[model samples]
Target: MSELDHASDPVVGASSRRDLFKLAGAGVGLAAAAALPLVPATAFAATPRFRLGEPEPAFILDPDVLYMNIGTTGSTPKYILKQFNDDNREVATNPTQSFGGVTPFRTLAAPGFGAELEEFVISYNTTDGMNKILAGVELNSGDEIITTNHEHPGGNGPMNLLLQRRGVKITRVNLPVGNNQKAQDYVDLFKAAITNKTKAFVFSAPTYLTGTMLPYKRLAKLAQKNGIMTIVDGAHATGMFNLDFQQTGIDFWGCSGHKWQCGPGGTGVLYIRNRVTKANPLPLFNFWPTNTNNSTLIEPRTNANAETYNIGTAVQSIGNPNYPMLKAFAECCTFWDSIGRGVIEKHDLTLSLYLKQKIASVWSVDNLYSPKDDPELLSALTSFSPFHTSSASVALGQAATDETAQSTTFVTRMREEYGIVIRNTAVPVIGSPAPHHPMRISTHLFHSARDVDRLVRSMKDLASRMDAGA
Candidate 1:
């Protein structure tokens, strides 16, 4: 469904659970789940005894359906939903008073991630954030961009646009797979791809496909050394990692709040380095506001720290912003802060590591597309082969993923039969002619060890069933 559908959702303004369910036929995503009945997805009761490193029941999800595909989107907790609903109604009552200007939100949000308010802005999503950064950059004809093959369309959309408009060349590094690869291998591939004409380095941190966490800090340093602009498609990294943007020395980064942050859809975070610091020595790139309320403006402003204009204001205050959505996103960030970002990241990674180890034990270590031992390459997403019979078939490369119906069939069955919601991503293996479609799962603060076990066991049973009597 579209954003318009969500905006018109009757359940979004529902005052009670009954009203929510009655209005619920909204869809399968988080926006719809808000109004759906709280059906327990697992056998575990929604008990009140809070334990250490366990999933919290702060949000109401359809218990009947086990949702593990958080990388796609997430279930917004009740507190955020309640605030969003209330704010929406309040805005309706007072339409003229524009609660714009993200300074307050930025101030509340930045410290948690070790950034300053001047460098942050609430964005529509990863796509919107990427658009903002790309629009600001003064790209020239014949300039080249370096990225990975694993990027989502959100990041690729802007790069592809640059390619079409400015005649800029685009190069992609075919990322390696499984436990054999290290963080250095990623840096090496990107370094080899860079040339004298390269103007920018952009890529997703933890790629959606194969869930590989590319070394961002090292890559950013590489870009800085080359005097090239860095744009990070950090869609899944925001809430999953305690990011120190300033420390990373990246020029720009964009992330989706709806995925791991558990914020509303159409909400995201964008970090743009505001001034020249020791972290980045290159002269500031001249940027003009594409969507701004200011009738008059300045250009090619100073990139130094003294009396600097808040670049965040120019980006954030463009047009009338969604006060409710932005407010909810701020609240979500606060929620993460209150719980401690470090604590949350630890829990998320721990769950993912557990699932990865379990998969290795059951399906063999080679089946994993995500790294296991190296903490640097790990993320909350775990991708692997569920086809027990054809697990070794991929060694022949393209034929395995191209011919196999296992990924599509297994994902469908998991949702329809097993009452679970997860996704499959196609990965471009080094020598493979066709992309290897691996089953992917996201472990978040809303899931538990039981949730992990259920997913693994259900996958095992279903894979056995689909194994053609192997």
Candidate 2:
């Protein structure tokens, strides 16, 4: 096949691997193709050029611990760490003034994420980004913001602040779980919930609890149809997905630089849609910079044709910023660009699917909180009930304090005995009194089928022993 042909091929294409996986996960007659191992050992041996675990050496993770908790945070790459140390040393030796704002860093990092220089801002992690986004947007009393019940505290905290301060009403949609759900189901739910008072759609792309990648583009389009705004908490998407701000159709996106991007802590990327596009052609909403020194200079875009002011520069020019950490964060984006975001996304999702399949084989599919059959809902994070046989346990009110204790013990023993670092989340089961605590695992570029297999085997054995009351 020619290079272009390879790029467009559904089965072996470099750019179409996600589509291929989507078809496979949806059971669209690619069963034999989906069963094949990822790269090198499969029919797609020659294509994609990137292999699973090829970037393992780039990270300085301890060999003893199988760290599968990228959903919470990620380990910085070795070269980036060295560069971060060097930059810090230089800054310490000579006092550096950041009068120009981090425009140069944003310039280097924005294109890789499909964002313009005027839209991308380097902030302090997802929480800071969420605060900036929520505080900047113009909202009034009685205006309603639609979001999901599975939101992390990062997004929830800011929305709560808006509620107390501005009297904005928060409406949360109860999210559905498991393999049976589709992306359209979420869109329909949100559409049904929207009222005349709805002002914005605030939601997480991949919710931290269940790892379901809510359809941001569809939701954004829905928001646009109602002349509202969309603010996405893309905490787990910045480094996990090949993101395009324009195509995503979101008005504001707050993401983490430390999670999947593996940059220094307290660093993040915030994108503000400064111009209108075909995807979201609604006039830009009125915004005021909350965490900026140049508030007087920044003006919200009023028309669809041009940007009135540099919103990124306004939000990024807070006081004397951490220059070294921001520089390292920019360098991390460059490194991800060098590796190709599509390649990383493919590897991460491939491992995630493999792990999901393994868990389904051993425990059946009913216990999973994360969706697997719908590829649009798939993310690098997978969450499942290790102790329960079915989600019906929730309806029976069985996910109680004892189950929470067992889940905590499972996490502790996974790290202590098996040397694997993973986390457990309290997933809210619809029609249940309390939330179900399930194990959540993150698959990234540093992992392979072998690592996934090891995780499955360890989890299976540990769950078996714990079930037998040993």
For each of the candidates, give the backbone clash count.
Answer: 4, 0
> Of the candidates shown, which would achieve the greatest TM-score relative to the real structure?
2
CA lDDT, candidate 2, residue 254: 96
lDDT of 1 by residue, 97-210 (tens): 445545677787778776778788888999999988887887778888999888899988988998998888999988888877788898899899989999998899889997
- Model 2 Cα lDDT, one tens digit per residue, 1-470: 11111233333324444474754454433342235434332323432433347444577788889999999998888878997888788778876744244778899899989899888998899999999999989988999999989998999998998899999999999998777799999999999999999999999989999899998888888888899899999999999999988778899999999999988999999999988888778998888888888848554476675677888888888788888888888988988786677767776777787778877778888878898877788899999987784355553344487788899999999999999999999888787777888899999877876787789899999999998997
Candidate 1, residue 417: how far the Cα is off, in Å: 2.1
Q: lDDT of each model, Cα atoms only?
A: 0.75, 0.82
Which regions in candidate 1 have their CA more than 4 angstroms from the true location?
A: 1-56, 97-101, 388-404
Off by more than 4 A, model 2 = 1-18, 22-51, 54-56, 97-101, 394-399
Q: Tell me the lDDT of model 1 at 355.
A: 77
